[model samples]
Target: MSMYVRVKRQDQTVFLRAEASDTFRTVKVALGDILSLVLDDIKLYGKDKETVLEDEGTLGGFEIGNDDVIFWGQRMDGSTFEPASGN
Candidate 1:
């Protein structure tokens, strides 16, 4: 079954459709396509904004659910942004 996840960055939010088996890399590619961003520069965090979601992991492995909110930010110089919590 397909699910939807909300990817937020600052004031912008994007809803991505995905499956439980979809890898983070796949999601990043989709997000990159939508926002015209470089794949390697995209970084994703879990709901808490502290857990970095690795590219090789699947959504189910991360326990991400339908309607769950994940954070997105850009990677710069091998460092990722500190996302604001409780968005």
Candidate 2:
């Protein structure tokens, strides 16, 4: 089963076809491919915008499902953040 989700980085957001049963680690891998960054180098955020998503576990565990939004950036954890760049 696949879900379409919104993912943003810097000034752009892309709609991605994500496998629903995949782990957050899988999302990292796909984002790595899309954003040209290594898996370890990417950072992810959810709706709260304060929690850094480091979970290697499944997206279902995070309560994320279809049509969710995941914000991504190159900024390291603890670095200064601007408001997520896209809607």
Candidate 3:
């Protein structure tokens, strides 16, 4: 089934239509396409903003549901950077 997910990077947000079976890498590629960034530079976080979603993991495996928020940030120098808080 298809579901919507809210992907956020600081104050910027994008809603992506995805399927439970879709891999996190797929989501990253889509986000990269929209943001004009390299897919390898994108990193996705869970709702808690702590857990790093694995590229091979599926949305359903992460328990991501419709309207769920996914935090994203750019990877720099092989280090993960946290996205600025929207608040």
Candidate 4:
């Protein structure tokens, strides 16, 4: 089974395809050697939600299902506490 993670940033969006068995937690591990952001610094959410700073565990437990997606990036507002959509 293959899964894809779509990483979005202010300047770009990238799709990473990987095996479903890979549990390399954290967006930093998923986007390795690309942009430089620590796991704690990476702000990730679904297409419809937001998460707290130390919430990587729950984020990781949910596998990206077949064709399922994960959205991750640096916060444009300069604060991890801010929402991505600016609502």
Candidate 5:
């Protein structure tokens, strides 16, 4: 079983799907691929906060479900990517 990770980048949100058996590893790799973040540069946590998983944790242990959102260490700010309109 595989899971999909939805991440927001700039004006778009991208989905990276990988095996549920390899959640953490796959997510780090996907983050690296999509957000240009290296595996070492990524950190993840569930909404519950209790199930905190990091670089060395197993994917199955996380048990990610449908619409289970995860957050990485990528920086997203309006001032950086937003284009300025003529005032």
Candidate 6:
């Protein structure tokens, strides 16, 4: 069955129609279309901003159900991580 989910990116909110069986890759594709970004560059997180939604796993397997809100963020690369507080 198809379900609705919310995707938050900065100040923009996007409602998406997806199935629990859908993979994160599928969501990335749709988000790319809506957000006008490269499909392979889109990454997703949870409300906590720490739970990464990786590919090769079903949405259901991630325990994501109907009406879930996923936060959109940039994919981490070699230079993405940095120290928050440095002397």
lDDT by residue for model 1 over 1-87, one digit each (tens)? 999998888888989999999999999999999999999888888888888899998899989989999888787567765553447
Clashing pairs in 2: none
Candidate 2 backbone clash number: 0
TM-score of each: 0.88, 0.76, 0.89, 0.54, 0.60, 0.79
Could you arrange the candidates by TM-score from highest to lowest? 3, 1, 6, 2, 5, 4
lDDT of 3 by residue, 1-87 (tens): 789999988888999999999999999999999989998888888888878898999999989999998888787567766553442
Q: What are the lDDT figures for the candidates, one per model?
A: 0.87, 0.72, 0.87, 0.53, 0.55, 0.74
Q: Is candidate 2 or 5 superior in TM-score? A: 2
Clashes of each: 0, 0, 0, 0, 0, 0
Summarize candidate 4's per-residue lDDT along 13-78 as a digit string, tens digits: 767776655543544566755666565556665645454323434333564555555555555455
Off by over 4 Å in 2: 76-85
**On residues 1-76, what C-alpha lDDT tens digit does candidate 2 reach at each position?**
7888778766788677877677767787887887687776666787666567775766677777889988876755
Model 4 pairs whose backbones collide:
none
Q: Write model 5 residue lDDT over 6-81, tens digit each, in one string.
A: 5443344557776666657667787788667656654555545334467666556666665566554443352222
Task: For residue 8, give model 2's deviation from the true position in Å.
Answer: 1.3
TM-score of 5: 0.60
Stretches > 4 Å off in candidate 4 = 21-26, 51-63, 75-82, 85-87
Clashing pairs in 6: none
